[model samples]
Target chain A: MIDVQNITKRYGHHTAIDQVTFSVAKGEVLAFLGPNGAGKTTTMRILTCFMPATEGSARVAGFDCTEQPLEVKRQIGYLPETPPVYQELTVTEYLTFVGRLRGITGPKLSSALDQSIGRLELGSVRHRLIGNLSRGYRQRVGLAQALLHDPPVLILDEPTVGLDPKQIIEIRELIRSLAGSHSVILSTHILPEATAVCQRVVIINKGHIVAEDTPEQLSARLRQSEKVSITLKTCPPDCEMKLRAIPGILNVLPGQAGGSFLIECELGRDLRDEIARVAVLSQWGLLELRTVSMTLEDVFLRLTRHEDHLSEPAEATVSASAERTDA
Target chain B: MTPVQAVIAKELRGYFVSPIVYVVGAVFLLIFGLLSYLYVGFAGAQAIQLMQMQGGMAQINLNDLVFRNLFASMRIVLVIILPILTMRLFAEERKLRTFEFLMTSPIRITDIVVGKFVSVFLIYLGLVALTTLVPTVLMLFSDFDWNPIWTGYLGMVLLGALFLSVGVFASALTENQIVAAFVSFGMLLTIWLIAGLGNLFGDTTAGRIISYFSYMEHYDRLLRGLIDTSDLVYFGSGLALMLFLTHRVVESTRWK
Candidate 1:
């Protein structure tokens, strides 16, 4: 459990995070979705008590981070962006150090170490020096260090940044399996990671929380219009104007192919029936037809970047919707 | 392990793994050994010449002839080499970003600072203790009072503790090890040089007070086996001051 209330962090005149407020319930995995330098790491640092916020407060496990850092730290297992590991230490040695630092010892320490190493699948390289290991393995060692203490809260900053595709999938599956047992707050720029593993997403940009919702709800909330994409085999010179003249059709734009057209309509309106009837009466050869919904990527781009991002060429929307099924 | 003991163990393990400790230790021992050998040879020649000139086995006090000078010469060696040992203590952690790991943990800042200081001090102690082997062997072949030799070692220990405190303070100021080493070197050199300037005043109260701030007088007294409480107070207060300043720097680092 964590609660951050209007915490602002400023380094002189430059504010890293401004009045950011968010909370995580027990066993809920929250995604901190943001691009680079978007105050995600800053918020996490304030929560972890590495640094105090310039104003306001953050509490972890009912203890104030600034005033009761030791207690808050006792509840948290943090994996910083760079994976704070000693290069000369072996994986098992490093984990043992962390475990002892956490006050776990004897059989308990070994069990915690074994459980974390097994979870991260680091048993093969346990005896190898961390500096000699590959970056992915080092990252996994970082993960193992954080998990070894088995704290109530886990704050991971870009946990899957350097892993391979299979490793990424494995890490995502591991995070997904942590639900209902760990309160995980993972920050990542990769939108699919949030979609795959998180129960709630908090999108931060320029030191502000731009949007916060479930993955599906985030996309649905940002949708200003619905779209219908159709491809006609026959030539249609006046088809664009006719579709624009329709009652609920917002606008008609070019689709992928030559005879293809994209029709934009008001939100929550499924104009497929009207489009189909018009295609039958006009006999404009309906080769293929489908409705396009905005994807999480489009929602992210719209909220973080220029709001008019989605209203660009219809091809952008088409590709965005095409990416939806990929996730 | 307790928080402080765990950090000390980790730090000691770190020193042994790095090449800095071995290189610095070898150089320190080599200097001690070479100086001890040269003093012994020089003492032997003096005794032989004295016998040839006037007498039957003229007196050559090894403490005055060898151990005193040996201990004096080691001040320079410790000032130069000790910084190399301590430069990486806090600076390397800052550069590697492991500082965040330590700070975010449940350990107190004082525990970490004291742990690192004691760990390096133990390594230095081991190196200094190794030099005692030379005197230990010399004692078997000759007769000399052991009091001054032990006091000289006590002087070296106090002087080194002061040097290491300054080193820990300097290392806390920056993330660059070379810069840390040099800053400490400059500070120690400047403090030692203060005594030279104080002598310009020649027994004036200001000169006496200024010279008292430097370590040379107290260390000299200890080297001669005087063991005054003032000298002990001087080393104790100096070490405490440096450690307190180091604690402040470490505590303020999280804010920065």
Candidate 2:
């Protein structure tokens, strides 16, 4: 379990993380989504107790980060953006060192080391020096180090950043397998990765939480209007006129829908009710009727744009519009 | 073993597994050997010539010769060997970005600092051991006493430890290994040369402060087989001050 309460980090005059707050329950996977410089890594650093917040606090597994950093560190398995690996040491040696630093020892340490190696599929190159390993293998070793101590909370910052598609899939599967046993807060700007692995997503833009919900809920927010496509036996000459006369008809746009008229209107207006009324009154045969739904990608773009607009000052809008050019 | 011991063991293992440790050791031994051999030959010949000219038995005081050689040899060791021992201590960790992994662990800051210093110190100690041959040969062939040899080495260890501490502290000040090495060498040189300036100035209050602050002044007195309590206190306090500063620098950098 992790609770980050209004944690703010400031470096000189620049605010890196501004009053950011979120919570992840045990066994829950929370995806932190943001573009570059969105305070995602800053937030994860606070949650893992790697860096103290300038204001407010966070608790990992019931231990306050500022007050009991060692205890918080004990419960966290953090993989920083660059993996924080020692290039000179062998894979096994590096993991063993991390294990010992976390107070793992004797047979338990051996067991944890073997388990992490197997989980991350690092058995083949366990003894190879980390400097000699490929980038993907190095990333796996970094993940293996985080998993060595078997901490209850895992804070990974862009785990799949530069991995190939296959490595990304492997890492995604690895994170998915860790879901129910370890509470994870994975941060990445990659939408598909977050959608594929995280149960809940927190979208941040410019040091603020723009949106937080399940993938389904976030997609729902983008569905302000639903467009229903319909195929009739004939394209009626007065189709737009007839549809506009119906109640709850926000707008009626008629177009060739597979050789029939297409109807687009407000969501939940059930233009289906009004379209049925108009069609029956006019005696036009209906062939196909389907409502178009918004995808997660669409929701992401809309929310990020909306957040950008909301954060912009009114004076900048005019100058931005005047200087803007279309290519 | 205890946790601190476990950290120390792992640190030592790291030192041995990497080429940096062995390279530093080899270079230290090479320099120590060449400098001590040259100092012994030159000083032994000169002492024998002076004793012959004074109508003595041409059997120079080998103890005096060893004391002079130890002091001369240590001057070069502190400049070159001390930097190699400490350049990579904290800077390499930062360059590799492994400092975060190490600092964020459950181990206390003191443990990491102490463990790293102890490993470097052990390597220095091993290098010091190799130089024992010069004094051993003198005792075997000539009438050199072992007291000055032991005391000189004791002074060398203290001076080396003090220099290492300063290097360790300087290493913690930056993430660039070259910068740490050069800065440490400069700091050691300033302290090494300040006593000569003190004698040149002669008895001024500033001169007294400079003399009291000089690392070589205290070390030179100890190399004469006389362990003054004030000199002992100065070396011990200097070592403590540097180690404490190193710890503070390391702790502050943990967050950054």
Provide the TM-score of chain A alone for each candidate, in the order shown: 0.91, 0.80
Stretches of candidate 1 exceeding 4 Å from the true structure: A232-235, A245-247, A273-288, A307-327
DockQ of 2: 0.47
TM-score of each: 0.95, 0.86
Task: Please give the lDDT score at residue A5 for candidate 2.
Answer: 91
Query: Each candidate's chain B TM-score?
Result: 0.98, 0.89
The best candidate by lDDT is: 1
In model 1, residue pairs whose N, Cα or C atoms come closer than 3 Å (at least 3 residues apart or on different chains), thus clashing, are none
Error of 1 at A237 (Å): 2.4
Tens digit per residue, CA lDDT, model 2, A223-326? 55555666677656777678777766665444433334444576677678668767777877776666655556555666666555543323332222222211
> What CAPRI-style quality would you assign to candidate 1?
medium
Candidate 1 per-residue C-alpha lDDT over A89-138 given as tens digits, one digit per residue, 9 for 90 to 100: 88998999998888998999999999999999998999988989998998
